[model samples]
Target: MDEETTEEIMYMTVLGCELAKPNPLRPGVNRSPSYFETLKQCCHLPIMQKEGFYRFLQLYNDSQVVVVDPESSADSIQLTKRVMYLELFKDLQVLCTQPDNVATRELGQRVAAELDVTYGEQVGVQYRKYNKTSDKTRLRFVTEGMLLQLIGDNPTMAGYSCLVLDFYEPTSNVDRLLPLLKKAIGLRCDIQVVILSTKYFEKFALYFDVPHGLTIGGTSFPVGVQHVTKVVADYCETACHTVNQIHQNESPGDILVFLATDIHVDRVVAKLRGAIPDMETFPLYGKLSKAEKAKALRSGDKSRCVITTNFAESSITVEGIVYVVGFNSIGTFNFLDPAKEEVYLRGIKDVNAMNLIDEVGIITPAGKVAATLPIDLTWYNAFNEAIKLGCLSELIDIAALASVKNPIFLRPHKTQHAADSPHGQFTAPLSDHMTELNTLHAYLRTKRNMSTQELATWCNETFLSSEALEEALVLQEDLIEWCKARLGVSEISVLTPDDKDYDVKIRKAITKGFFLHAAIRDDSDQPDQYRTLKEGSHVWIHPNSALGGGDWEWVVYHKIEPTGFQYMDRCTVIEPMWLLENDYFYPLPLTKDYGGKFWLKPLRAIIDAIDSSVPHRIGG
Candidate 1:
């Protein structure tokens, strides 16, 4: 017998830092906890000492560990990325990635130009794929998600020795990556992982079974704080009260009020616009286009009021923002359990439940795959369903758009009559989803002209973001190609509402993938209110929605972000049977007992299937 030769794996040794995982079951469901309520529950994952980071660098030479700097600001991250690049550019390979792709691109390009490297020679930005350089490229800055995709294909994280993660989120990014990095370290010990986090290093240390990891210090800015004597629990109400107080009585300075959802931000903007017609108010959220977001960040106005969600928390800095009315609450992950038919209603306090898992099993291989990559179980399942439905061509694009901070549609303030005027042409009274889908279809039709200038003009005239439309189309193509290669499918048809079976195809796909987000209007007289199928919470269609009247009985939404209420957006009309047949909520009772819509036969088919599956008992 010949002796077998195999690869020897050296595991990365861990250091001491302890952070405890919050129990998924423990977060109080006492009527959606406020921002402060949730934040107070978090443990400050402590590092043993300040000098630990320097010690790790000395011993391992090439080690990847979570970088925790308690005092570091957002500016400190960019400084660290640049300082490290300058120090290590000569000898070692380096890659830096941030949570936001837009920020990543901005940094990558800035670094490229400053270094005088032929833009892509040393740095590159994707979705601007044509500008990327050859393999010799040493320093690469991208979104953490973009790099995670690369690492999935190449487990050894080829061609890069030092990897710096830009920013970390507790439930979504940091928690998901820990297990995979541990596995990767087990395979290749040479890789160095640099984590730039305010906290959560303890979880990293414990999960990897290493001693507490290193902690480095960074400078912090001093700021004055003033709290109102009154207590307001509703985020939107608090925002309005705070803005009103500041706009009316405060001194000259910019006001940055952080609300929870884009819709809420828009609402706050609307109220402020009415209250102070002379003040410059800007709504900043991920849904805004690059150009639109720049409007909020512009410096000419000395005392602008920027109403925003958490998007502005760390990423954007408006110099004159002297008053920061920050909300600690975050709608970070919109999660639903496919197995339980439960919508976490805007946000999940139970971070552990965000990942897809069976009740009994720990981590499936699929879970592990999701753990490594940045996408959620909803997207992971959607791609799986898309493959099964042979609609991977378009579903992947929608999933990609859905996964990002930047939602495809821009919610222009009501005061922008011009923007709102063009939207009426695209609005489908019963379905905001159809409205957006139609807009995208119309935009796609314009592509036949093959002129970027023509599309730009159309986008501007039509109140669409030219940059957003371009990004979505480009992302769609990339996604389809990747899916085809992965699934080994020769071709997958992209479904559109124009096709004969398009409505059914898309709705069925959404139902299969995101049934947890489904809701039905109560049979009574409340028109604007809807009861989610899983959680049974009464939510209203966002006033900003085309279908704010809430006439539809059964609808599916792209997202349900919570602030004062679970506000639905990107909703579409659907047959009630879709919910009745969803496996996650099988044998579910309908809103109606014996009679449903004229289209539905009391949901008769579902009852029959359930009855047929069980054997009749001869005697009780």
Candidate 2:
């Protein structure tokens, strides 16, 4: 037998410090604020950011489609402010792809403060459970989902002259949005789109039919980079020791420590506080309330160490940051289960990897591949699957019910062909997640008759995200009201925990969306492994799931994580009879019972036979 081996090539760049240059602009000159000018005045840009700023300004002024790859959060924020200051567009809507509520709010408030206009009066922030935009508003920051809802309401996107996609992450929403944007650009000549990304710049330009693109490169103050030759045992301890070393040896300046999660941040904050009692230490993460985040961002007289998650890296800008300590937790993109976006971290070897200068240092991985990587084909199929599973159908129905003007592009269309390539299969169905959320919210609000305070308390006690729960409750209310007004339906039916058949009803409702994602327990495996009904893919229940320890014969999963062994997320136990009840859509005609080993065979055959070209009913 012969085996094949591949060679590993590593690319690394160590930045060295450079002298600062004096400001070139004359005082009080009558000059318009270009992206380049505004950013330079605010803060120092590394070599790459300055080059990207120049190229972006050139392409934007020419009205040529441009996509910018920003190296830091400061770069994007400064560029956005510069554009708003220019006042070239009538209305600018900035879409945020990440769920960093604090960062998004900070961006809006900062821009509003500089312009001397009140927040929510001239500057708007819109996301789940929060909407502040009005007719008087000129600049708005919104989540990508909110923008989708906006497009559904007004297909032409009337009155919006510029759309700025703040970050570039591979998401199904972005894939669904580009075509709609392309159509909108075609319909109106005044509309323009600015994409700010750290990756995938070229693919975006190619998709939008832009021939030329820009890469940021110029001379600026270099960052002192250091690499560890040996691996350390514990990252938190290593980070604390590094911070102590920097505080003692380095100059008087703020330090930034990057950890992976809130728990890690808390641990590091506690250790650093005890280690250096004189130095102020603060923790920052997405889950922190607005007040907490503000405190972390606030600059104090005491030399401080800001410990935070990776959210701070790309979405936030902390002032007076001269030293940085981070782990090698870089995301390696995988096509099959792209939603598992987080990567694990390792220690920074045995040495104290700290920059001993005034400039912030980065201990990044070896380096990134520079060539433009091809967009995976799975993204397109995943979007199509979302539409087929009625994820977008409800949004369209709501738009039509609320009297949206021509909700075009994505109608309630079903799959044209049944048997897609195995590689194209979606690990998570969007519709299933939606149904699960709706069911949970109804149980909490409608059946339990819980007040807002009670729901908050319940969420806290259950270790669930209150923000997510609140957003779901808001969506439920809007959905019910829309149905009542348009279809004259007084009330919609929902099952709660108090109901007699609550488990059966909720399980069936959620399982219906996962008709293609059903799995049966394998007798050969002890507890964790199960085989998918359609593809027989071996999977395990995610360790954090409530059903992980249960001996359920059948289950329906909403998502999968491909970590050597596939792990199911957001899983629920369901009866096999429930799938059989909906035989028309999910047939189980062939079954074998031999020596207590039941066989549910060839679900793909039935799935292929079903004619999905015709639009199906979305909800009861």
Candidate 3:
């Protein structure tokens, strides 16, 4: 007879309810028809039938079973016969009634039992706990090392049988392990492979890429749906405080807060402790020692808040997490100068400074970017180097006007004014290089009207270097011209040939520009007894000043020079009132006597000396 005819006859016998003879090819215990009949009505196979049926029996006898399903045919007998045969040795020991639901508790139990018997009773199945109190919730298998050990111990079992890989889903690591397992199985073809999962069966089938060798059970029903709550950085901090506040007013449960970094975790814990003195706070970061982590996990505190980073996202499950908070901002550093000179330190800046600066300007000699504010000492040094290199002409131009590609432009309105101002638009008075240049320009203008000896006297009196002043004056012209072109103005200011008191005018201008440095009197009765309020120390007029010992009633305080090798601790007191009365102040003050020099007794004495020498000329 042909193969088709033989199959047809087999189907006919199956439909006729003829009992299949026990054969070695079938590989399972054969049960009586009476036991089969018991499962026929129940939709599920009876335990006795399950033990006896070839497919179910093979699940226990052999570590692996492979079920092949034939195509449906018009001859009901043939179809039924093929199905009955296939059902006897299905890969998944699915219930004879409803065969889907492959990862159910029943399936797990059968798989576990089969593994235990085949690999020895030492084999145990693990499941992760859904509830904090429940130990066995999620199912995790033994490590590959342990599995290899089992195979070694039972060498006869290794080639003769196969292990069932059953899970809800395959992780990335599982995908990598499949090919390796297949290669191992090739050594002994007697080993069979059976994969059972609720979903991703199609993916698995494609992964294996074979015909009827792969068998699938029924689909799985949805378990209790649980929603995932995302906690951001900002939310974490706010939530931590809010939860602590809530705990203070009301009862507390387990509160979980997610921070982005370990530093943040520490900060949150500290803040919680300070804010809520009564509530207990704990930190969970990856850097924690294994023992410490275990201790934290096993804390079993009823009313505690756990502050952690993303480590708690999906890893170890914690109980009673009713509330969750996440921090959105990853705190970072903000520098003033790229060269790192003077840093106005703060937490994360509004914009990433290093990226922004590198995008706009080239690095200076100090390997730093020039910005209005120096984030660090290096940045400040870079700014100065850039200025010296002429790479950065102005801070405003670099920070505010420099062309940027795909820039994040921000126009914030000043609180003092209604109009909006672009970022980095506001300029510092004395801090800017422009202020120094302007002071030089005014000094040169005053010098054009003075004789050489007079110029020398003024230069000597003000402690101003004539050669340096000359160089600065020449550079001043170039700077003024540059400023003119930049501002779109015609004509510029220049220094004259023979101008006396040019140095004094320059010193006065420097003093005027930085009047905020005014000295406070340490003792009113003592002469030349003044300490800079800014420095918070006793200081006399710097010897460099022309009026250093001229006995001024009121002096404009600029800066204090500390005792180096030559100069002692002295403050440079310039005549600020001279500039104030002369209308030299740019972005002029609302009042002529802005900081009240008469009332400023210590400053008044210095001012009096300068005014006594000259009639306090308005302008050159």
**Highest-scoring model, TM-score:** 1
Better of 2 and 3 by lDDT: 2
What local distance difference test score does each model get?
0.58, 0.54, 0.38
Candidate 2 is scored at a TM of 0.59
Tens digits of lDDT, candidate 3, 1-620: 76545544544443333244342122364444553453243233221122223332333223443332211111111222223333333332111111111112233344233222221121223211111111211222333322333344554334223444532244433543565665656566555555543334455555555433333222122223223265534544675657766586655566777765554566667777677766667777544533445555654645677887645542344545656655443432212114342332321121123232332354433233222221122223323333333333332222221111111221111121221222123222222233334334444665997888888665444433454445333333444444454433354322343546433443443343334444544455555556543333556654323333445544444234332211222133344455443322222221213454333444454445445744344222
TM-score for each predicted model, relative to the true structure? 0.72, 0.59, 0.24
lDDT by residue (1-620, candidate 2, tens digit) is 21111100000010111111221111233233342344345556642243454455556655635677665666666566545433323444433333344456667777665444568866778865577766667778876666766776777778676777764464655766777878878888766677776666777777788776655444244578776567977778888988999899988988998876555677788788788988989887665544567788888989989998766765677876888888774333422232332321111210111111112333322111101101211122222232334333332222222121111111110111221222122222222333334434443553377877786565433334444444445554554454455334454543343767544544555555455567877766468678876556678876544565576777877557544358885676776655653433322333345553335443433333443422242121
Which lDDT tens digits does candidate 1 get at residues 444-527?
Answer: 788786598887777767767765666666666665665565545787766654678655655666665667777777555766
Per-residue lDDT for 322 in model 3? 56
What lDDT does candidate 3 reach at residue 175? 42
What stretches of model 1 exceed 4 Å from their correct place?
1-66, 70-79, 82-91, 114-118, 127-131, 199-221, 235-252, 274-279, 330-404, 414-417, 427-431, 486-488, 494-502, 544-550, 578-586, 589-620
Q: How many residue pairs clash in each candidate?
A: 14, 0, 61
Candidate 2 stretches greater than 4 Å from native:
1-56, 88-103, 211-221, 225-310, 318-465, 481-490, 495-499, 522-531, 561-567, 584-620
